[model samples]
Target: MINPVHLRTLVEVVRLGSFAAAATRLGYTASAVSQQMSALERDTGVALFQRSARSVLPTEAAVVMTRHAAKVLTDIDTLMAAAARTHESTSQELRLGIFPSLATYVLPRILQNPAWRKLGIELRVSVAEPGQTIQGLRTGGELDVALVYQVGQSGLAWPHTVNRQWIGDDDFRVVLPAAWGIGPESKVAADHLSDMPWIMHHPGTSDATVIERLFASCNLHPRVVAYSDDFHASLEMAAAGLGAALVPELALLHRPPGVVVLDVPEIRLARNVFALLPKEQLTAQVQLFVELLADTLHKLGTTRRD
Candidate 1:
């Protein structure tokens, strides 16, 4: 194989028209540069220079080899640059999974945060609810971390390889249409909801299972008028006076018109949001993001105080 160092020396020597000049630029002795050119010539089995007392001039073959060497060096540099970019993309990228409802509020906050900017990380997000997010963590090599929520002790599956940390709580609130004659600040009693029409989640979903049990535990079951997993749809249904719906405080960040958010002191059904990782170990970016996210959620909760 042709030594790239020798070839490079040859190119410089040819461009400068003197071994002494090339050696000066490369910080090598003139004799060393001459030896490198002589080895290069022996490797190629061709005379590379015509030596005379007046000057050492490049032979036709040497000029041609220099041209080819420049092109080869350029291609090698391009290849090395591409390899470096691929390494950076793999090392500095973060893959995150979150729920659909959270994508609407939390995602933008996480992306736009100054802390996120400082991390110099590229984020790739996948929107899936808790159960699906957990499953993805188990089998999906692409998922590095996840933001998920669980309603008090409700069963969730996980392999022993995962780790969980509580980030914050998203408290559920009673949403009533303006026609309900209830002020937004007024506390609604549990007993009053009995025999009242309500909007609920479809059966078998994680949220629906927890919410159904919550109402059952309170000994209050209302007539179900609509079933939807979409918080926005549920909010719209409640605003249309279709029925009352239970929604998380975060879901109300964009509080739609015609619906009043009320406190249900008799019920406490807050979903505990958590950060789930493949293992307990966290990269600097992930750890910083978790801290910033907790701070953001705390500020949001404080601002929405009833």
Candidate 2:
């Protein structure tokens, strides 16, 4: 009998076209992933990949197996989900991992919705960053679903066994201290703020790297005055006239009195938010919960604009 675990790894290898890529997504070492592929070939008595010094090329057999493996995996997931639901109680408890911004701005509003009460889901919420929330969705981890965001090439990856759903995009805006005399209607260019002090994310963060590259592309090399990872804190600091900060629209919903948000044509970036759920854990209730999140996120954006 072929191991389902190996099949999952095989699917990843074929989809990503390299053992190393699959390794990163599945949280395995490249060597371990290679070994799993070897084991899978042995179980099936067929050559799965053509291995070269720099690359691993999937064989015809590998592609065929992957196609079949997808269906097999889906069936296995369905079986597991059905088995688990057989013993489920009236009010199902869902372990949800979410980032701070969404939890703060979107969650409370969703909870108040009458539709949420009808879902009969008791949410066990874990508020954390995307990295932590993703970890919680892995096998043997605590969360059944995680809400995460990816900014540019942030290198965020999840296991192939996890299903991903696109929620919405949170666009970043250039915010200046009201004291700086930059108002919402000011047509600003990147060079205009090049010499100004700026509040930024700490160096070495994925978002910071993307934002830095964006600023560099726009020829805006801001002098660093402060570093803040928290969007709310960044807003507060900007309002305090510390420096200009780039904040997402979601965070701007609760903007303080002294910060002016501008739509800088030069700085265009948005974090793509998604919900990750393990295949076997996906259920009607969970899908409904994700829908509620997407709806709330849309409403939040609309409310901010209005």
Candidate 3:
């Protein structure tokens, strides 16, 4: 392959019409410039210069090659500039997906994080559930990063091409209507809910599936009063004295007015929140955002406990 450096030297030598002048302009010795031109000629199998003892002259071949080299160099410069711009664009832009509940409770804190502004990442978000977010990662190239959660080993379908980093766990707490007289900090047993009216996620969702299994494992069958996929909506139903619903710790960040959070040890359904990205597209900004998210989750957990 012809070296671009030698092509450049040859072009300069042809343009300047003297090896010595080209060497002076290029900050190389005349001998070095002549060696480069010789190497280039050898590589091309064409004599690029007509040489005499007193002065060197560019041959027709040399002149033609110089014109082509000038254009080639310009093209290379343009390609490099375009590549740099693309890299800059990637660094500045972030396409993020978050579960609906996280968007409500955690997204504000993420936006408020100083690191978010310091990184200058422009975010575009998709508010979706965990399953939908995972599907988006597989089908759509639009998302650079997705914040998704899995309820235990809920058998959620995730693309193999995605890489996951565990951000944190969202512990599920049973929320009952205030009128039901369940103390906010009281530990409720799984068997205690056998006959209670329950507000749950749509039956087929990862969350609902896990909750259903939890009930089955405890040999308790509760009557489903209402079904809602939205945590906020489920919380509203729970608050209205309709039934109890399993809610994540993050969702409880803005605890509804009429609901009391109960501790259910036997029903241990903690959803693991992860930062999922297409393996090939994980950039520094995305990694930093994941780190910031984990930190934000920790701070939020602490604040809630206090």
Candidate 4:
């Protein structure tokens, strides 16, 4: 069989019109070039060049093969280059595990990075609840990074093999139903909630920490009639007047018709969003994602409040 190298040599010899010139151009001995063309002829069962003492002429078939070989070599070079670039760009996959609370809101905005497409990043986002995310990261299941609300206490005190950064501060303020008559434009305070039933995040979750802080600040025991871990479920329950719960601004991206985000002062009930990544996850792509996520959260903190 004719090697691509040998075929390339045949094409060059045909183009330059001499074995010596093709050899000079290709850094091969003249005799080597002649032997390659002979091998090419033998492989294809057709003589490719007519040899002379001074000039080598192409056989009738050699001219056709030479023309086509030029295009083939060009295509092969292009394919190899593109393949190399693809491999280089996608050398690593970014496995990101996001808390469910964030999967529906802030995470989408981070995906809109102008450079995401260019880098050929394969983003794998796991939308398990917070506990599962931490579990997966700890057990080395598959998370390269995670976005989780900072629980008041760390569960996996395993020296945190990952690097972490606080992304944003989400005020765990109250969410009141539209009919509360708090006025569409008014920011409700904790004191005004004296007559309102309290809606709090599910007991023992990150949001619960903020809720407990709010009650302690008011010096009143909360009448938390209902609680939910699912943000959407908690919001719906709140909309239906189950009770008023504190939800972050990102969760309220598109407000329902009868809801208001009540602002509270020095509300210690705030969840500090954090981006967690394994130390090995600090590749250029993962670093870019972490930066994108942090920037997105900061923007939401400033501009996304309802």
Candidate 5:
């Protein structure tokens, strides 16, 4: 029987045009690739390549073997891809991921559930900034599944390799400096902030863009006092007489003594959250938890999302 490893080395060496190049691509040393070619030739009882100082050229028999070897490699890749698809369609472990805020807020309800534990889910979760999450998916380093927050209608973009489920909606409200005496019972207009200093989200972030557009709609852009990624920092700043900030109502774990949340009059532009998976790795467990998560969010009236 022919050795597939030797055949693979042969194919790589020829396709890549040299042992050195193939070795680099395959993470083998140049000496190792050369030894593999010699061993393969000895096994076949034929010299497969002619070597000179500069390069290696295939022998006539090697030419024919390379052609057939290419087909073998192609078939192997096709078989592996199909096998992966089958596995994804049949898997049971529920590996998971969620954005940091949701990790702290809504995710606990699903993760800590007594009933879900009965499903025998092999639940794994990860928390990180959105940029890190996307990077992880690309490199196969971090998550096989992810729940993320995104702005407008686009949600998160995880390459064509990922499949997404739109899970929930996230909206922000205008916050007033503390001692403004606003409560959940209070209603304030966006126009009310037209004169107040706008404590915007950290610059170069989605929140900044949304906050800018909202204030522009009110025909104003006041001096932005501070920009920070942390909502608590923004809240503290606003409370300290810095400026008004836009804070997400659901994920605000703390309200410093001086800040008040006010409903923006007729305000509606918001981000939607998503559940994501590598298109190549959506195991059955991934599907169940995502569905359960959506259900839980819906039950909590976080269900207004499509």
Candidate 6:
């Protein structure tokens, strides 16, 4: 293949009309420049110069090659500039993994905030559960940040190298069918709920274990009428009078009309929300995003539903 370096040297030599002068401009010895021109001629199988004892003159072939070489070099420069711009745009993008409830309720608020515009980050979001999001933070994973929550002793683990920051808390609210005569202002005792039909998390899962233990502590063994992992589905089930359900405040943002959220002091538990990042990926933009997300969550948590 013809070398681009050789083409560059040929262009210089033709333009300068002297091997010694081309060498001076290119930071090479005159003999080195002559040797390169010879190699280029061999590669192209065309004579590029007329050599005499005093002068090194460009042939017709040399002049034509130099003209084409200028265009080739310019194209290479343009390609390099385009590649650099692509790299800059990729660097400014943030790959985020978040759970469904937060994505549905909290994320929209953050996006609406005026502060989010100033962060100047292009978000590529993946909506999944906490376990899935944590998996996306492992080595060779696509996510740069994960927003997850932890229920009491409901063990969720990530790589030790991952960095964590406390964002906010999502307190669980006990929701009952309004037809059951439970009012929103009701302060239901845990023991009174012992015989109530309940929609619980699927058995043996991290969340279910914690909730069952909490119920047992209160000496209230709920009769499980249905099992669901999705808080939205659970809320709908409760609204349909299938059973009472414990749902996070985030999920209560759009509570169905037939459900009444109660304040159960005996079941005072909350899922702690956190932001997870790769140790090396904790940039200022990512931190700002987390801060905005936390602020949004706090506002949502305090917003009352009629």
Q: List the residue pairs that clash in candidate 3.
A: none
Q: Please give, for residues 113-149, the per-residue lDDT of candidate 4 as tens digits.
A: 4434434467787897666787778885578777777
List, residue by residue over 1-54, the lDDT tens digit for candidate 1: 344455666668867877777766654446556767777677666676665455
Candidate 2 on 121-218: residue-level lDDT in tens?
88899999999888887757789889999999798989888999999999998999999887789888998999799999999999999999999999
For 1-306, candidate 3 gives per-residue lDDT tens digits of 454455556657767777777766654446556666776667667665666545343321222344444455566555445544554555567788898777887788778754456444788899987777777777757787888888878877777888989988888878889998878677668888888999877877766777888889987688988988777888888888999888888778777799988777787778888988888766544665676677668667777741
- Give the alpha carbon lDDT tens digit for every residue of 224-296 in model 6: 9999998889999999999999998888888888999988888989999999988888754576577667766
Candidate with best TM-score = 2
For each of the candidates, give the backbone clash count: 0, 0, 0, 2, 2, 0
Rate residue 280 of model 2 by lDDT: 79
Instruction: Provide the overall lDDT of each model, using Cα atoms, as 2-decimal numbers.
Output: 0.73, 0.79, 0.72, 0.63, 0.63, 0.77
Give stretches of model 4 more than 4 Å off.
1-90, 151-159, 184-189, 266-268
Q: In lDDT terms, how accurate is model 3?
A: 0.72
Order of the predicted models by TM-score, top scorer first = 2, 6, 1, 3, 4, 5
- Total clashing pairs in model 3: 0
Question: Per-candidate TM vs. native?
Answer: 0.68, 0.70, 0.67, 0.65, 0.62, 0.69
| CA RMSD per model (angstroms) | 19.4, 12.8, 18.1, 18.3, 17.9, 20.7
Displacement of residue 1 (Cα, Å) in model 2 is: 33
